[model samples]
Target: MKLWIKLAAALLSGACTVASAQNFPNRPVRIILAITPGSVADAIARFMSQDLTARLGQPVVVENRAGGGGAVAAEACKQAPADGHTLCMLHVSTFSLNPFTMQRLSYDPFKDFKPVTRMFFINEALVVSPAVAARSVEELRKLLVANSGKFSYATLQLPGADYFQAGLSEQWGAQVIAIPFKGGGEVVTALLSDQVNIGYAGAGNFAEHVKAGKIRMLAVNAGSRLKEFPNVPTFGEAGIKPFKIKAWWGMFAPAGTPEEIVNRVNTELSRSLADAKVRQYVEERFMESAVTANPAEFASFVRQDYERGGALVEEIKRAAGNK
Candidate 1:
């Protein structure tokens, strides 16, 4: 009699789970970020929130849980119900950089969050302030070798900028310190003021400044020359190799979120990216909108992102001799 009762209860529980998923997102949805409120992360999150609320017919909100290289927001998402209402919108760094850079991460990015969709990829660029005489990367490297302790590398929210800077410094056998700022805006400010000699930052961060003649881009990490700068060379053309540190953004929900909700969220993202206004906004920021596949494909890519991130971090640590 007890065995029969337990079996009935299990079946009932399974039914309830399916029923809840069908009524998914019955409440307000919230997206959390680990960046400052006015940052690119916040802007994208708010934009997505507005679009999702309109389409999903729920009051979607943006929550800023900044700090600890995105651990703060990620952990908050971890503890939330896996109902798909609560989500995290984060940079590629949270998965690609934090694991190796941060000494202790509170949650496993892979296990705590389920991949929903890839939002966009920001083209990264290497640039120098007008105070620096170097016009190209080769020239810049030579200048650094000559004036070893005089210049520095500016890093913003992208912490791995330091790792790449360090790698460059090691390769060139020069001393270009990695100076970190809170956001891209600040890095732009410092670069403009000649407080930092050079920086590897999102192309969006330097676009206006580059146009105003405040700084010069040494090389850009893109497939080919951008229409805006038809004359500039790509990293490969500049003889800079394997420096493909990606600047991408993705959306995710709590680990236990139902697969149905995950697929729904991904669909919503695809729709938003296809929106003409949203695409224009992304382009204005010097970012390219993504063409993401379905949930399972994105999840597989997320797993690969972590694996590649781990290997890159390990390589950096070994090169720096971090025991």
Candidate 2:
């Protein structure tokens, strides 16, 4: 009699889990943003919410919890119930940078959340204000060396930007001040207003300004010259070896969420992102679609990135010391 009762209980528990997964998102679903509005992450989240809502039979909302280099949003996601209802849109900074740089991180990317899929990857570019007389990266490097300690570079509070500033300064035997901002939008604004003479961010951020002749794009990390600016050289072509790093935005669910539900969301995201509109949007934004094969694949990718972040942190510190 005891054994029968135990088996019944186990069967009921399994049934409950299955039901929970199937009925996932019975209410509104929220995708928290780790950065400020007007960022590429925000744009992509807002763009996909409608489609996700329709597919899930529930409203999908985007909430910005920007600050602390993605800590605020990450904490919110970590504290949320381990259900499919709450998700977060995190980026390279959250998974790759903060773990190694922050003195105290509130959550672990691997322990606190489940990676759904990588949404997109962006390539960084070096842009200078029109006030600067450099037309190309070589020219800019010479200028920086000649005018050491006379320039300031604007960056989002992430290691990638700071790493570049440090690496370039050491390479060119120059010293450029680093001014950190809260978001990409702020960095772009600073560059546009000439508040900073140098800026490093997604090439998309400076596309229009470059066209307007307000800023000059010296080089990009896109592996080749951009189609839009055929004359602009890649970092490799400009004489800098390719930086072995990636900047991507990915979706995550609170840890302990059912694998079934996680797969469901991943499937929907894949379908939604396959739309022609999304592809066009990605291209226009100067990004590449980076949907992973599955959740496990994304998890593996994160683990690799986390390791890379640690090594890069050490390299960044060394570069800073050399500067």
Candidate 3:
């Protein structure tokens, strides 16, 4: 009788666990953001949260941890329970650049996290102050080469040792100085104040300034023209086809999360992306919608990006050494 009772208890416990996993997200879900409130990442998080809440019938709360260039929130997500209720909305830097730039990271981006789905890809643009004599990308390249060390370009950080700016300098053979700032807003301030002659950041950061004619956009780092800046040519269009980079954003769950729960979250995220309102919001925000990919496909994409970014970082380090 004792043996039978113990067996029954074990079976009941296992059944309860299975039931709970099947239902999934029985409580409010937390979406962690690694950047400050009112940032582009935050805005994108909020947009997804609203659509997700409506579709899932549970509130999706966005919590901002904001420090260490997204490592704070990323580590927090890493420590959270792998129950699918806790997830993160991470930018390109979180997975690609941070791993290469930081000497020590608390979590392995690929090992500690599971890819859910990509949200959007934001194309970066190269902008110069009106005072700079560069109307096009070709002209900008000539100016940068001619001026060389005389001019400085401001960016969010020290080109991350593997970031787009560092790679760009190597490709162009220009010795333009790099000025590191705290955030995108500061990059703009440095440019406006004449502290920096040129800047490279998200197109969203310069959208308003470009519209105001305070700064001139030489070229975008996209394969084609951006909808928001139809007049601004792509690097290819401007005859500098080698310089192209797009920063992407995606959702990730902690590693060891149940496959069923991962699928559920991916399903809801796909639904959200397909919604007309969500599409419009992303388009207006200067984000290109991610091509629909299932969990396995998304994971493969992440791995490819990781390897590509690693190679890019190596090239950057080599260039930095030569300089």
What are the root-mean-square deviations of the candidates from the true structure over C-alphas? 2.7, 2.4, 3.1
lDDT (Cα) of model 1: 0.78
Residue pairs in collision within model 1: none
Q: Name the candidate that leads on lDDT.
A: 2
TM-score of 2: 0.92
User: Candidate 3's residue-wise lDDT over 56-150, tens digit each?
Assistant: 78899999876666678789989999888998887766776678888998779888898998888876788999999888877877887787778
Error of 3 at 57 (Å): 1.3
Question: Model 3 segments beyond 4 Å from truth?
Answer: 1-16, 180-183, 243-245
Number of backbone-clashing residue pairs for each candidate, in the order shown: 0, 0, 0
| lDDT (Cα atoms) of all candidates against the true structure | 0.78, 0.83, 0.78
Q: How big is the positional error of residue 11 in model 1, measured in Å on the Cα after superposition? A: 3.5
Ranking by lDDT: 2, 3, 1
Query: Tens-digit lDDT track for model 1 on 1-323?
Result: 99999999999978877887788778998888766665565676687678778988889998887766667778898898888888888776688778778877888877888989888887778999898899988998898889887788887544542556655755776767778765666778888787888887677778888999998988888777777887788878888775535667888899988787888888887898888888887777667777877878878877788777777776766766742
> How far in Å is the alpha carbon of 87 misplaced in model 3?
1.2
Comparing 1 with 3 on TM-score, the higher-scoring candidate is 1
Model 1, TM vs. native: 0.88
TM-score of each: 0.88, 0.92, 0.87
